[model samples]
Target: MNAAATTHHHTSCLRCGRKLTSTKSVATGYGPTCTRKVKAAAKAEVVAQYKPHQVAKAEELIEQGGLIPLRGQIYLAVSSDGSQTYKTHRAACSCPAGIKGLHPCKHRIAAHILSLAA
Candidate 1:
């Protein structure tokens, strides 16, 4: 059997436990409205967890395609200077700020955001 045919889908929305009638909803395990609300809440949580500047820089890096995935959970992020790159991971980054453990650097934040989206 095909993978899609073998897969088991939920009959209720995963978020609200509402009955799911549509094929797409069942497959995704969330209703359309619940999907939007869940996404918004996740975005809000990310924003609240990080500094505004760090979030902004991470968004910029994503928009610019400046983060390059390397091995597992590792990425190369372009430095603010645009001339250098730093090794970035969800837990650690090679940037100066990260090295000092002051706070999560933009590179590390960007890697984390990308992983969430993926």
Candidate 2:
């Protein structure tokens, strides 16, 4: 017997008990008549509404060598280690400013400035 014929069959949606035309297993196949469509639509809506400003800020940081200087001799370094998903990791100079609870140090700021000039 074929695999499809061997599988157990359920003809109603698990969520709403409506007649099921298709399962959500396949990529492009029709899904459960109501809940599947609603869930998928909601997911798309959330993704579409993402903020562009935050994305642009990150790109600017990349262009600037992932380094920023705030005040005095403080420097900050931002790093990431993920393909599709980004995980921000920061490193700072070991200057007194950093050790005293201030963000970044002078070394990172200098590096960033040099990188920008070049």
Instruction: Give me the candidate number with maximum TM-score.
Output: 1
> Which regions of candidate 2 fall more than 4 Å away from where they truly are?
1-9, 21-32, 48-118
Q: TM-scores for all candidates?
A: 0.61, 0.20
Pick out the ten consecutive residues of candidate 2 with the lowest summed lDDT.
Answer: 81-90
lDDT of each: 0.69, 0.35
Error of 1 at 68 (Å): 0.3
Candidate 2: clashing pairs of residues:
74-105, 75-104, 75-105
Clashes of each: 0, 3
Kindly list the per-residue Cα lDDT of model 1 for residues 1-118, writing each as its tens digit: 3322233466876445699998877766667786556345437666888988888877666544466667776977767656667799979998889899888887887777766654
| Residues 1-118, model 2: lDDT tens digits | 4322222234553223456564442211123343344334433442253344433443334333343333333334443321111112223444345456454333333333323322
- The list of candidate 1 runs beyond 4 A from truth reads 1-44
What is candidate 2's TM-score against the reference?
Answer: 0.20
